[model samples]
Target: ASYPYKTTQQSCKARSSKVGAIKGYGNTLRGDEEGMRQALDTYGPLAAAIHTTTDLQFYGGSSSGHGAGIIDIPSCSKQVDHAIAIVGYGTENGKDYW
Candidate 1:
C-alpha cells in the first residue's frame, strides 16, 4: 500500500476527475474575515488553514468539563500550520467563532 506523494495540483485534478466539479478560492480569502463568513453562509462550508498554538492543540470539548466556550488563543502565531474545515460561524457570549 505505498503510493508516491502527488503535488497539490495533481491531487486536485485527480479529485476533480473522480468527483466531477471542484472550486478553488485560492488566496482570495486571506485577511478577509467578512469574505470567509459570506462564503460559509453561501457555500455551506470551506477548507481553511490556520495557525496553531498550544492552547488550540489541547482544546478539550465542553462535554469533557473543560468549559463550554469559544476558543480564543490570543498568543497564536501568524504561521499557518494546520488545515481545518470552516463549517459554520457564530457568536458565543458576544465573541465570534468559526
Candidate 2:
C-alpha cells in the first residue's frame, strides 16, 4: 500500500477491525550475522540495523540509487541508531544485497 507524505503529524484513524495484530516478539542473537541469516531463512524477516550515511539519505534520488550494488561499511559496528526489518536478501548484478 502507498502512503502520502504528510508534512504534519496525523493521528491514527484505522478501524480496529482493519488493523493487523502482532502475536509476540522474539530477539535474534546479538551481533551474529550467520545466526541472523539462518533465522531469516527458517522463520522470517527479522529486525536489523545498518549504519546511516549521507549516501543513504539520497535513496529516493534517481541516479545514485539505481546502481546494482550492496552498501557496506567495514568500520561499522553493532552500534545501531536506527532499525529496519530484514525482509529478505538476494544478489543483484553478482553483488549480494539485503
Candidate 3:
C-alpha cells in the first residue's frame, strides 16, 4: 500500500506483489514469561496469545512517574485467542515489565 496516496475507505483489491517471506517459526512454553522474554531477546520479536477483556482494553497504567510495571492479569487465559508480538522488554522505575 502506498502511504502518500492511499485512501482510507478504498475497496479491498487483490494484488500480485509479494512483500516478504517468513524464514522460520516456532513456539514457546505456555504461560512462560521468562522464556518468552529470552526468545524475544535472542531471536527477535515473538507472537503470543492471551485473553482480552473490557478491563484490559481500558488499562492505561499509572502516570505518577512510577512508570508501568509488570502487567500480570491473572484473569487472562492461557488459551490461544488474541495474538500480539513481543518486540522488546525492560525494567522501568525499578519495575520489571514487558
TM-score of each: 0.65, 0.60, 0.61
Off by over 4 Å in 1: 1-27, 65-67
Q: Each candidate's lDDT (Cα)?
A: 0.68, 0.66, 0.68
Model 3 regions lying over 4 Å from their true place: 1-17, 60-72
Q: Write the per-residue lDDT of candidate 1 for residues 18-73, one digit (tens) a residue.
A: 65566655444477889878777877778877887766554554665344578777
Clashes of each: 0, 0, 0
Model 3, range 1-98, lDDT digits (tens) per residue?
A: 26432324676666679897899987887767888887888889887766776655545455632334456666756566678877888886786666
> For candidate 3, which ten residues in a row score worst on lDDT?
1-10
State in Å the error of residue 77, model 2.
Answer: 3.0
Instruction: Give the per-residue Cα lDDT of candidate 3 at 3.
Output: 40
Clashing pairs in 2: none
Q: Please state the error at residue 70 of candidate 1 in Å.
A: 0.7
Worst 10 residues of 2 by lDDT: 60-69
Tens-digit lDDT track for model 2 on 11-66? 86555565666787767677677777788898787877776766565354235343
